[model samples]
Target: MLNYRNALRVGTASCLEETSVDVSYEDGSPDDDDVPRRAIVAVLPPDQETRILMLTTYLNLARCASHVGRNKDAVVCATLAAGIAQHDEHTDHLITAKILRSRAHLAQNHLKQALRDSAAATELAPSDHKSVQLLARDVERAKRAALRANKQLAKEVSTWVQSAQSKFAEQGGNEADCAQQ
Candidate 1:
């Protein structure tokens, strides 16, 4: 399994390193700032000589995957990149990886996990860094999404409760009896 996973990572990194593609957001809205305008590929030489190069490759692959809506793959790649960066104590790369994973989680509507990652990224970056600014935007977006989801869930539950109450009332059951049931 380790060998297969490594092979997959190396293969994907090779392709991403060799490729340069324009990236647009999944939605037409302008607020899609999670991904770069162009895929961040091949910042280092293709030699893949150092840990930083590997980290870049993984980050680029994850970004491309997220751009293309392969969010699950993006999450895996970003998590791997985050692990590498954390191990190497590379704050910038770790921040990028966390933001990418947060984006993937947001895309999948895992709002709680998304919020956690975005917050973590925000905390990791220096206050004046561009990454922190970007993370601020993402954290706001995630909060809004969570709020909307919570409102929707409350509405649904309220509707269900109302329907149940109406049915019980029609069947001549009092609120107290229904509560006991």
Candidate 2:
């Protein structure tokens, strides 16, 4: 079993090399090809370390996707990372995944979802991690800004509707007539 695991790791490494894909967290230039990394993670044994590694890979993929302006793919990868972390009861990975997912949501303008994920991350993160705390705070500010924008939009729409209604009334058209049309 140990030999098989080693062989699998070696094979995955070779495949990654062949694909020239770097799914490292610190890698500024990530490869566009994520299939090899995904395949390796899919075949990893259901062990604690392997699970953590898989979550890490997913997180990296999410980051890469976001960097490439693929917000939808980033959200998908982050969601996968979060799910795996939750299933494996890996608190650190869970926090990391939540943070990543929150950022993805923010990028996609999913303010509510971003707020929720950021709140979860803040709750799960340790007090020592000041960076995560700051991220959570930033997310909170973004959520507020989104809420304000929505409110402003609603007010604008209401005003426009009222103006249209007044114009229709001037043209001898009632609400019922407008509804029928």
lDDT against the true structure, each candidate: 0.69, 0.70
lDDT by residue (tens digit), candidate 2, 1-181? 0012222121223235664443322123232334344334334355788877878899999989989999888877877777677666788887887888788888888888888888888888888788588778788788788789989999999999889888998999998887677
Give model 2's TM-score versus the native structure: 0.63
> For model 1, what is the error of residue 47's alpha carbon versus the real structure, in angstroms, after optimal superposition?
12
Candidate 1: tens digits of C-alpha lDDT, residues 108-148:
98877787888898889888878667766876877887789
Spell out the clash pairs found in candidate 2. Answer: none
TM agreement with the true structure for every prediction? 0.64, 0.63
Model 2 lDDT, full chain set? 0.70
Question: After superposition, which runs of candidate 1 have C-alpha atoms over 4 Å from their true positions?
Answer: 1-48
RMSD of each: 12.9, 11.0
